[model samples]
Target chain A: MQFQPADVVARASFRLPAADSAEAAVRTCRPLQDELRPLAVEARAAGPDEPGEGFTVEFLLKLPAPQSDDVEGVLRTAAAPLLARLGLDAGKLDVDVEDRDAIVWAGDEALSKGGTACGAYVVHLRIGRDPDEPHELLPEGSLTDEEARALTETLNSLFEQRPVEEH
Target chain B: MSTPAWWDELMSVSDALAAADRAEVAYWRGGAEDGREDSHEDDVPPVTLRLAALGREFASHAHELTAEQQHRFLGVLEDVLRTGSEADGTAVATGFFESLLNAWNGGFDLQAAWAGVGAESQACCLDLNQFWGIESPEWMLPRVA
Candidate 1:
């Protein structure tokens, strides 16, 4: 089966290792950002929240696949390179796929076979906090803005730390 | 006895045929062996052996397979890759064999590609060289990922 386009995004928060602010974390993640780009995939970064106080990132991925099911495994595979490049280890990666079959073609055989006839195939993905995992401070009711920020900060710090001794 | 060109082609074809048989066997074995239809027979040793044979044949006749067969082979590879990603490894592998059979029957130069591969690990390289149309198995190429 041919794969349609795919979109993937992951968000998380962690404190900076030496730095006290989210800016440094943002900077660190910046260089590694392009690594997340899938072939024919677009990527954008949004907010550490409150002008620049907390670290919260959102990634968007688009892939070329016929079904939503086509996006997941590719997204997962893409994550490995990002982790290495960012020097950031993920506490949680919330991956989501959206089949953006907004338009349909009138004459395409694929459309007859159930694929959208027109417009680009799209898959939207989001990965962030996991409510199931217990947190020390946050009372879970979905991550509040502040809680999400805190998590982002923690992730930043964890990722920013130096690698251990390699013999 | 040193391998002859026809012998190689026949071997490759036989392998493709065997892979088809294994895939059928795997489908049938799925329910009873795993209890949940969890097994993917495509990746099984038998199927891989079959894909290897086709790869050897493709290698042998690289020039012949380079024709329109290249595109068709790429299509099959994509299917194999996608299925392998979603389903069990064996099932995905088997899917490639099934696809290879389709390409072979369709008149693609599967034997040439299989034959071109060097004797050493030519069989093992079928899955690996799937894209450039070299050592790749006729079952897998042009993968989406």
Candidate 2:
């Protein structure tokens, strides 16, 4: 699958342990953003909270699509080294891969069915905490039954649209 | 003072891996004593079962493994793969490895699987580049076309 620069968005969130200070966490993550700069249309790091205790560093990346079919490989290749550098514990890091096209398709399908037109669909296809729940299409609150049906149909169609490869 | 369920599951996986290791050793030793290459017909089933159990246990409780424990688990898995390679061949070893990998990956939450076995443990368990036959860092390069 190919992606237009706008079509794919990659986010990596590094949730540091309570023992780690925000400055230290940002120090660890800054270089990662630098390293990722060449690969992403935009790469950024968001922080250890100013007043709060939690420390989280995030990278928001945009890349052209027909992106690799190996989305997992792409995300791992980018975040693994950075995570190792931080010496973060298991379950502390999260990476999200979103297909904007799929999100738009679902949203438009929902709108077509009489749902309120939200500005943009923030489809969180993957989240760190609830990794097992497949296809979390968001703008999360409540969906009209017709809107939900349309969204589901849109998702199913998107799945069917993937290119079949010979084993 | 009670152990967490995840820890219990990890212990079960460790036990299963140890049992599989012993079975493999015995299978090889028996073949050597008989001065014959073992067909491994009898050995495969039990070992497979144990590996499957290990995979299931890991899938359910991978997040529970301490960093040290994760390293130890990876080391044991490497040993299994190495032994399988030496005894049977790369094909057999690779097949065994892939099966276990699939089961382990399948057992996890989808996001975890997609995120992969965390950065620290990834190199020890499987090299994504080598596994996918993509060059390192270069694969991350965006395509202009």
Candidate 3:
């Protein structure tokens, strides 16, 4: 991850970490590289997203084939196995899938509390890697600097923080 | 104003779908609490397919809907987002909102259709990308609080 300036705004398409639990997720939930499987899916860090050796994980929503009932239930079910397989919990890390081609971001801990999980096609949280990337995380040009910092700080901390477990 | 027949059918199906969604969420919640790893996949999962069916039906007549009807269509979904469970919100967004939003993109005045709803619903429209990557127009984007 590149060094982030305070003014850098992140325009992500997935649910960001809740302002409250972001620090906790970063510190407690983030697993070491060995903990997670090798990121085999193609990286979606396009259009100014530089992966910088960081990885992107594809959250595939495994639903009961052909049954379209309780999507949230299905996502919840799919997320636990997937997240558990990755050693992530719903609080610090839970899975929620959007519609077709959408994968609930493993980085999204905000709605993991009580809300249903939501996702993107592929999650590449290039939050602050590049400075000029105008964000759409919020509305066009509507994110106050304070909101931007609060959001990016959590995401930046996701990669920058050390994994104490590995040590 | 009196509602259109097709709109009524859509609303009826949506209500049924919402109830099924709640039941399904509860069922999964129960299963999770029981500590079972997909013990019930044997039963047919119908929500995803049902939504696709609704989409096809909605699309067939979606272009004919008036802006007022659009308001009503979105209003029901908006209410679900507001009053339903978190699971319900996700369900409506994924199932109904995604379907209707796609139909709107094909050709309906979403802004005009969204006119009757409150700022909250309008904001919901703007946040489609947050759900499954439904990109909203620059004009439809709301000012974040």
Candidate 4:
């Protein structure tokens, strides 16, 4: 199944050390535009709010399946130089990747059974955060049965169920 | 006009959806004559006022909504956003309603989302803080004051 361009959305927020100003945050993040320029469909950095706690930078990329495995690594690697430039600690960064293709697969499954998929086809993954949010179905069509099963297995693996406690 | 008892019954997904629809219609009616000299004494649209009331009410009773109700409400909200985007002219009331929907979604700190809603509303020349009776600008943004 062919995926659309810009189907992958990667968002990263960096919380600067307490004393950082909005100007400093922007200056630190400005290098990312040059680093991600080649891979991005669209990219932007939202300036830090007045308190200067943090700021966010987002990228929409048209990555093919072969490059999927290295997404997080690429994100971290791209962010590293910027962090080093700003003398910011890596621990303060939060990264999230949304796989629109997986949502498309889920949506197709729903639509095949005559169910409607609402809104946009997007799957939000907060990188290191717990997976508790309900997944939404993407709008339908495409993907082989084998591919669908594999993707389903991958998604299912992300959420581990805890054993129930007996009273 | 007195608030309907059905408004309190909005814990049901179906009722919530119906309330949203009714609120949208009422908002449009009020917004239609917004700048006219003959506009009603209550300059704020009934939908905007009702949604703000609903936001407060829903926040207090949010836990009462079933998981299914929360999921369905999110879906309904996405539809509302889609409809708002497709309209020839986006309405400030729509942004206000979106803020209420985000508040109802809960779980995350909604300051940033609220800020975006406020910015969108003001871009359309509506002062959400004044209309919603909000005092702090920080409440609209993600920053904690």
Query: Please, what are the lDDT tens digits per residue for candidate 1 over residues B1-145?
Result: 0111222333343344434444544443444323345544222222232343454444445454444454445444444444433222332233234334445556766555554322322332354244224444434333345
Q: For candidate 2, lDDT tens digit of each residue in A1-167? A: 12243244443444433423223343444445445542211111123321223344333344333445565555444444433443332233334445322111123343233221311112222222222124555755699999999999998998876678899
Task: List the per-model TM-score of the A chain.
Answer: 0.28, 0.30, 0.27, 0.29
CAPRI tier for the interface of model 2: incorrect
Instruction: Classify candidate 1 by CAPRI docking class.
Output: incorrect
Compute each candidate's TM-score over C-alphas: 0.22, 0.23, 0.31, 0.24
Better of 3 and 4 by lDDT: 3
Q: What DockQ score does model 2 reach against the true complex?
A: 0.01
RMSD (CA, Å), each prediction:
23.9, 22.7, 19.7, 19.1
Instruction: Please write out the lDDT profile of model 2 over residues B11-127, one tens digit for every residue.
Output: 454554545444543443355423346444332222222343455455556566555665566554454445422222221223233344555445544234423333332442344
Error of 4 at B53 (Å): 36
Task: Flag regions of model 2 displaced more than 4 Å.
Answer: A1-167, B1-49, B80-84, B88-96, B104-145
Order of the predicted models by TM-score, top scorer first: 3, 4, 2, 1
lDDT by residue (A25-100, candidate 4, tens digit) is 3234434433443121111122333112232222232322233456555445444543444334444444545532
Stretches of candidate 1 off by over 4 Å are A1-142, A159-167, B1-70, B82-90, B98-111, B115-145
lDDT of 1 by residue, A1-167 (tens): 22222433332222223322222333344422334432211111112321222222222333222333544455555454444343333223334344211211122342232222211111223322211122336443698888889999999998896979899
TM-score: which candidate is best? 3
lDDT of 1 at A102: 20
Interface RMSD of each: 21.2, 21.0, 17.7, 18.0
Better structure of 1 and 4 per DockQ: 4
